[model samples]
Target: MAGLAIPTWDPETALLIGTILLEAIVLYVGYGGLERIVGPRLLKLVVGGE
Candidate 1:
């Protein structure tokens, strides 16, 4: 099962993983920023103020 075996030193695999990780981090930071900007107002509206 050559295809099933993972390479011990694979640059392509590393790059692919890195890309996915970077995207996840970017998304996380963006969502955190959005929450910081909108969360308080949304919470207040939902809970009927203060």
Candidate 2:
């Protein structure tokens, strides 16, 4: 696949790298927000109440 192929001096290669980086950052932030919102409630449930 082209994606698995070696890097080239093509402009398209630069675009692909930028897209992947943005996706990674977005996913990381999304998961962090989810953990913050669910963390305390889940902890209380498992710890048998506050």
Candidate 3:
């Protein structure tokens, strides 16, 4: 029977995982910034208020 093996460091896998993590952080920050910039304007337009 084969036993479970421990995880090893793989450059390709590390890079892919890092890329995904970086992208998530970037998207989160970008969306937050965009919301801060556009949210109030959008709310005013939707509510028809100045």
Candidate 4:
């Protein structure tokens, strides 16, 4: 454990990580928007609500 070396920053790895993070954020926002748009209609259809 004492001989272990700390990892250094790699630009490629940083870019990959950043892209994944951005994709996750985009997906989250898109899903939330779709849910807000569709959820109530789906619930009404299922529960026979007016």
| Top TM-score model | 4
For candidate 1, write residues 1-50 as lDDT tens digits: 46897569689989999999999999999999999999999999999877
| Candidate 1 runs further than 4 Å off | 1-7
Better of 1 and 2 by lDDT: 1
lDDT string, candidate 4, 1-50, tens digits: 78698889899999999999999999999999999999999999999989
Could you tell me every candidate's TM-score relative to the true structure? 0.73, 0.71, 0.82, 0.85
Give candidate 4 misplaced runs (Cα > 4 Å).
2-4
Per-residue lDDT of model 2, residues 1-50, tens digit only:
56798655789888998999999999999999999999889999999787
Indicate whether candidate 1 or candidate 3 has the larger lDDT.
3
| Model number with the top lDDT | 4
Query: Candidate 4: lDDT of 25?
Result: 100
**Candidate 2: Cα lDDT at 9:** 79
- Model 2 TM-score is 0.71
Alpha-carbon RMSD, each predicted model? 3.0, 5.0, 2.1, 1.7
- How high is the CA lDDT of each candidate model? 0.94, 0.91, 0.97, 0.97
Model 3 lDDT tens row, 1-50: 46788889899999999999999999999999999999999999999998
